[model samples]
Target: MWAELKKGAAVAVWFMFLTLPIMVVKVNPIEQTVVWRWANLVWLGAAVFVLTVVGRYCSRHRTELSAFWPDAHPLLAHPQLKRFLLIVLALLATLFPLFFSSYQINIMTTALMYAVLGLGLNIVVGLAGLLDLGYVAFYAVGAYSYALLNYHFGLGFWAALPIGGLLAAIFGVLLGFPVLRLRGDYLAIVTLGFGEIIRLILENWNDFSFGPSGIAGIPRPGLFGLTLSVDDAIMYIYYLVLLLGLITIFVVNRLRDSRIGRAWIALREDEIACQAMGIDKTKTKLTAFALGASWAGMVGVLFAAKTTFVNPASFTFLESAIILSIVVLGGMGSTVGVVIGALVFILLPEYLRAFADYRMLLFGAIMVGVMVFRPQGIIGNPRRRSYPLPMAAADQEVGHE
Candidate 1:
């Protein structure tokens, strides 16, 4: 029975994919009729109906389905299967734009960038156990850096990208210096203030940032002076964001498995113990701050390039909260979990188009539900089998500086 349902879902997924294009194009029932727009909604309803039936059937035969699609089962936990499925999913995502509209590709591009951002925050909050509420400040810094460099100095998007990252890193270090003395709630407050300060500066500093109006007409990324604007350049941007997402994941995973990762874990679990074991807390914490900031910076640069216009409005305390929420909802210290969280937080809202007015209400309710029922997150950290990412060595001798 389980096997039958597992096979059914697999079949249903493929069926949906094959039928979607046809349904979207040919199923214009209301066009000749009176209500074309309503007819399109009807078609959407049909698609949902089919998907619901597939879900119900799959749920009914769980036991046999678990045996066949073992990767879907908790007991059949296999890393190899997980990796295989992830690879397949990545390939599908990479090719999705080929069949999707440019509009859809743009949405996916946003999702991918946030995935990278979430991955970066995962390092600080998940691995390093730092509670940073001002992460978006780094993102804002990166975006503004790119905009300023490109607009003021006549630099291209490609040239501005890394420079933006470097500037964010510098600010991260600068911010880390003063806040290192605080911890837990105090640290969170300071970071929160830090983010607000950046926003205020951008808002008031009309001489540089143009205040509330923000900097516009920023150049888009290009390849060898070839801009992506005229054609389906959105698809090209999607690929670029996808590549950055993949790199963020790869680099994070590698970091998690190394000695640096171990030190971070040590610091996260117990800073005092880590110190007793000759670990340098200051250095470890600073590294976490720096790396996390750098990640945000890179995303910020891409975001500015992608949007072609940015200002203080885009990077707010609420934005920081959402990004941090993705880290929490996805399960801290879990890369794939964060990605999943990013998708849910970033893309799920779009799916709720009908409930536009109640979107925030529903989001708040879901967040409360998650906190109450599964605070550990959907993909909670496994008990064992940690990654082997490297880290810089902690000072062996007594070194507070």
Candidate 2:
């Protein structure tokens, strides 16, 4: 009883530390805002105390609670039902723009964009076990490549999309080369520096990038003889991104089953052992980086086209962090997991817009809670096999005996 009480008290204190700023005190001096709403702190603290106690109970019973998903996995093996569910889901997605509010559709569009980014980043971090903080640099490279080519050279969105991807892939290879010998924190720091460097260059190079002022009036995408307009643009972009996201899913799923994918998984599991198995480390890593960046680059063009603007601010480290978080939270290397993570990360915040000021705090709290409860992730990688041999190999001992 005493231990539970102590734990509850501690949780209450922690929750107060996290939510206090948003719960009390308006600190925006620019609008001459200085108000203290301190009374609610007590109520909030008490509520947190009760919730924390209940959370402790849930944590202790997590295995029991989590059994439902394990149970459902067998049901998923029914092929016809699985296909039927998938078709239904796809049909729902196809009809989303027709039924949902424009605002929700816009949110889904953003989610799809992140899903693509997350899938790309998963190639490096999940499959290859790389820690790249400059992933957004490729995103920026793609966005800026399209923006500049379209702005200065009069290239259309369709024409510039592949070109942007190629440019980003080149940058990815360049990044991969310098960090070839690095790993873990060192690699992460280098990538972080690279991302910052890219942002700084975009911000400082006034003439080329137009500096902080940004490039505006970017042309929107269109079908032949149909220029996308404000009324239907979100829906069009939704379908566009949805198509891109599906292709990404298919490609990534295929790659995960391919020889290259096997090499990547081996590298991720044990680099030295993978090297001993004759996988070229440099080439493999570079390919992972290049492929991931290409996805981001392709989507970056759509991002630029969607917003009709490209600015250095849009490609900050925060963007990379968010994308990486989606990958991590979703279960790295799992395409469906990344998609779920993106939708959860993006849509949850939007749903909590009523508590706009506390959005980040809530996010932090939720992430902490998730990590504490599910260290692997919301959808972690599957358990590995106990033995890496065929049944024949296991049975060979009998013959020898």
lDDT of 2: 0.87
After superposing candidate 1, which stretches have Cα over 4 Å from the reference?
1-76, 383-401
Per-residue C-alpha lDDT of model 1 across residues 39-91, encoded as one tens digit per residue: 55455555655655666676666567746532125642788887898789988
Clashing pairs in 2: none
Which regions of candidate 2 are displaced past 4 Å?
Answer: 10-37, 69-72, 383-401
At residue 222, give the lDDT of candidate 2: 69
Structural similarity to truth (TM-score) of each candidate:
0.76, 0.87
lDDT of 2 by residue, 1-401 (tens): 68998999998888888888898887887898788888778888999899888888876887798886552266666999899989998999899999998888988999899999999999999888898999999999999998999889989989989998999999999999989889778999999999999999999999999999999988888688586668598899899999999999999999988999989889988889999999999999999989989998999999999899999999999899889888878877777778989998888878877776765665566657656655456666652323446865678558545
